[model samples]
Target: MVQTTFKNNAVTLIGNEVKVGDVAPDFTVLANDLSPVSLKDSEGKIRLFSVVPSLDTGVCDAQTRKFNEVAAELGDNVIIYTVSMDLPFAQKRWCGAAGIDAVQTVSDHRDASFGEAYGVHIQHLRLLTRAIFVVDTEGKVAYVEYVPEATDHPNYEAAIEAVKALTK
Candidate 1:
């Protein structure tokens, strides 16, 4: 399992670790409108998932905002999603306040489906550790970054590059 820490404190992560070239696992998350959204819902598009503990936090907010700003440039074939354990209502409210229309904010609060599927569930905290995953158009994981520190930012450039490659 990949080791993760929040504020230097080790946290147990459940679920199987995902690696590059692996078939992207399908998981259900709630859209801001409370509709169930699965990985298959966005079939044929390169998808980038920005997993975060919570959007209300500093790093998570910045991470989502950064991705939102770049979504348009990523082309119409790529969709960026910011997944969190926050409630759907909370996700909707945060996106509104942050003007995060480019990136879709999905909620895993119902069952941690996305967290467990992607191996980002912070066992004790019930929050997802920071991570980034770029799935190619064919549903293969092109790049995976499980941020060692939950409070830190992910490698935005690498993840973005992965999506750009898939678009080309």
Candidate 2:
């Protein structure tokens, strides 16, 4: 169980963080293209899941671009998506300005249903804490990392290793 503190108060996540071998919860998010995309849509492919609070921040922006660059090297077999509470327009603009073309940017502004389902929602902040989950082709989680602090970056090296393991 991971505990997160916001505004000096700590809150516990209701469920265990999604872990290796656990089936990822299916989600419907608005893509940068403004199309509804679900976990089912990316089934049968290696997924690099990057979940962040918002795209308007420096860390979130860096995280998305870094993943986009890494995704290119991983090729078409691996699909990467960065999720946040930003609107689709903002996400699209950020990606464009950053020249991030390899990774898809998705939004959870509608209800944050995806964040709640993944147990990454920051109750008090109304934002998502940085987290990552790598779901294998069979839909089982291969790796999961919920950054201890909302202001920190996720473990990118470990996430990349997880994706590499999936390709083996």
Candidate 3:
């Protein structure tokens, strides 16, 4: 239950706080095809869960694209999941348009599974606050960054560094 804000106004988050060393919470987010995707689907891989409110925004777009590029450089064992409350169709369209193949866009719009599970769900907005979670190959959370402001960008280098740690 981490408290955050959007443009200086308080917003409530609804879920357990995810910390380093904790077993990553399982969540069912929708793929671009509207198929269910969960942590188990990418088991045994280092996962970078980049949670954003919407891909269409400036910060969120930059965040996703940054990970997309990093994902391309990371080896096959590493996978990036971009979770958002946007619909699967929108996510697919945005990814295709932006040429974001390295990162997979997952939708939590249907049920807020990923949002709630990751403790990023905004009480009033029903959108996920900005955050990043790195899960090692063993399914343990290696790092987490819950951005204090919804409109602010996350610490990109720290998140990437965490993923790099898992790869090594």
Candidate 4:
């Protein structure tokens, strides 16, 4: 379990927490098309997992768009995926409305197994904490960033740099 305290308030996360150098655990998530998409599907490609609480928030929306823009520049060697708790239908609508076509958006609504396994599930808030993970071709995590504050943005530049390094 992952424990985080903010301004004297404490929250605990239940389930496995991903860390740098750890082999990313494979999980199935619903894609925008409502089809099952697994982490193994992106094997042999640099994977960028952008985990957000919801697409409805400003920070989450900004993060997704930022990754979408970066993914376009990162080329085909990297596969960028955004994971959220929103429904597949909602994700599809949000992506189309936000003009987010560069990165794939996935939903974890049916079960939070993906979120729980990744240790992004917030027990108290019942939402995921903003986090980012980069997995190499072998499924080993190369980078990880868990935003300390739930309301803040992630380190976008650092994540992009990490992805670039994986390509070279």
Candidate 5:
């Protein structure tokens, strides 16, 4: 149970906490078109999972945009995903409005599978806490960062460097 805060108030997160060396857990999220997407879908590629509460928020928007900008430089070997509890339709709309082409926005609104499997699920709110997970080409978790505060940004530089390290 990883403890996190939303607006400085402690919140309970219910799930099996994933660590740096664990095998990246398999979970299903819905793509913009309601297609089921699993971790195995991007097998043999470096995956950066940007977990956010909701894309409608300011911090989530910035986080997704930042990764979208970096995705171009990350090369085809890397696949960046923005996971949120927002509905698939809303995610599609937000991406289009934001011009976010590089990062694929997936919705966990259906069953919160990604949230529970990744240990970022906010039990009370039914939303995921802000976090970043970098999965290597072989499906091993290389980096895990559960942002302490839901509203604050994760260590972007560190997460980017982690992916860069695996790319090399």
Candidate 6:
């Protein structure tokens, strides 16, 4: 279990905590159309997993949009996926309303598979803790960030730099 903060209060996160150089755990999440999407499908590409608690909130919305903006410049070899616990329909609606097209939102509300595997599942809230995971083309985790607080934004520059380095 990992320790994180919710509103600055200590909270426990369930599942295994991933680290750089570790192989990413495979998981399935729902696409906006309710189609199943898996990590393995993006094999042989650099991928960024931008995880948020919920998309409707201000910070989460901002976080997703920021990554969406960065996605446009990263080229096709780098895929950015925003994972959250929101339902697929809600995700789709929010994306449309927010004009977020660069990043594909994946719903882990079905079973919290991604959250559990990545050790960002907030035990009390049943939502994912704010985090970022970058995987290399070979499927090894290249970087990880479990934001200390749920409401805070991640180190965007660091994550973006990690992906950019992969393209070099």
Q: Rate the local accuracy (lDDT) of all candidates.
A: 0.95, 0.84, 0.91, 0.86, 0.95, 0.93
Please, what are the lDDT tens digits per residue for candidate 5 over residues 38-154? 999999999999999999999999999999989988889999999999999999999999999999999999999999999999989999999999999999999999999999999
Q: Cα miss at 158, model 2 (Å)?
A: 0.6
- List TM-scores for all candidates, in order: 0.99, 0.92, 0.97, 0.93, 0.99, 0.98
- Predicted candidate 4: what Cα RMSD to the true structure? 1.7
Q: What tens-digit string does per-residue lDDT give for candidate 6 at 1-168? A: 467898999988989999999999999999999999998999998999999999999999999999998887899999899999999999999999999988999999998899989999888888999999999999999999999888999999999999999999
Candidate 3: where are CA atoms >4 Å away? none
Worst 10 contiguous positions by lDDT, candidate 5 = 67-76
Tell me how far the alpha carbon of residue 121 in candidate 2 is from the true structure, in angstroms, after superposition: 1.0
Give the candidates in order of lDDT, highest first. Answer: 5, 1, 6, 3, 4, 2
Tens digit of per-residue lDDT, candidate 4, span 96-158: 999998899998777776788898877776677778999998899999988777678889999
List the candidate 6 regions with Cα displacement exceeding 4 Å: none
lDDT of 1 by residue, 65-93 (tens): 99999999999999999999999999999
TM-score for predicted model 6 compared with the true structure: 0.98
Residues 1-168, model 3: lDDT tens digits: 577888899999988889999999999989999899999999999999999999999999999999988886788999899999999999999999999989999999988988888889997898999999999999999999999998999999999888887787
Question: On a 0 to 1 TM-score scale, where does candidate 4 land against the true structure?
Answer: 0.93
What RMSD does model 6 have? Answer: 0.8
Better of 3 and 4 by TM-score: 3
Judged by whole-model lDDT over C-alpha atoms, candidate 1 comes out at 0.95
Expressed as tens digits, the lDDT of each residue in 77-150 for candidate 2 is: 89998988899999899888888889988898877767877888776566777899999999998898888777
| lDDT assessment of candidate 2 | 0.84
Candidate order by TM-score, highest to lowest? 1, 5, 6, 3, 4, 2
Q: Considering only N, C-alpha and C atoms within 3 Å, which residue pairs clash in candidate 6?
A: none
